[model samples]
Target: MGIEIEVVYALPDEQVVIPVNVEPAATIQDAIRLSGILERFPEIVLEDRMVGIFGRCMALDHPVQAHDRVEIYRPLHASPADARRMRAEARRRRRAGK
Candidate 1:
């Protein structure tokens, strides 16, 4: 018997939930590869994207526990600093227009 867990993928506008059964101590990447999501989304093939278990960011080789919620994260559109700067710029523009 294998350990069964829930895997959730948060797409652009929707969420895909899947049940996965893997051996204990399986890595996040291992689970993702086994779940067949890789074939569906080739964009996630990059290593820069992060993977997590149960909402906590984890390493690709992190061991999975039974009933864990494995999540494959998408790459950020922009860095945090950049995003904040953009937001501030937008606010400045709004204030200037006001």
Candidate 2:
């Protein structure tokens, strides 16, 4: 069988996953370009973003395997530390019945 892969991109309220079929040993970049994700989302800049396969960081040159899931990550609006602190504070307030 031929190689089957998925390219996924998400926003705060929506997500798109595209299934793509290719010849044996397609690279991640090839899959992303073929998926038409960039055309759909004009805001995505390939040079400004990071992409991964199954949540693991991958290079554009990396060869894809069968059933590989490619993910395009959006830039975070807030820092992880700040987000965690906010969540913790909210939890504390809830526990105090605020």
Q: What is the C-alpha local distance difference test score of candidate 2?
A: 0.90
For residues 1-98, what per-residue lDDT tens digits would candidate 1 score against the true structure?
78998777798899988898998878888888888887777777638787898779998888888988999888789999999999999999999999
> TM-score for all predictions?
0.79, 0.88
Give stretches of model 1 more than 4 Å off. 46-48
The candidate maximizing lDDT is: 2
What would the per-residue lDDT of candidate 2 be over residues 33-66, giving only the tens digit for each residue? 9999989999988878889999998888889999
TM accuracy, model 1: 0.79
Given candidate 1, what's the lDDT at residue 26?
86
Q: What Cα-based lDDT does every candidate model obtain?
A: 0.85, 0.90
Instruction: Tell me which residue pairs clash in candidate 2.
Output: none
Off by over 4 Å in 2: none
For candidate 1, the 10 contiguous residues with the lowest summed lDDT are 37-46
Worst 10 residues of 2 by lDDT: 21-30
State the lDDT at 4 in candidate 2. Answer: 92
Q: In model 1, what are the clashing residue pairs, if there are any? A: none
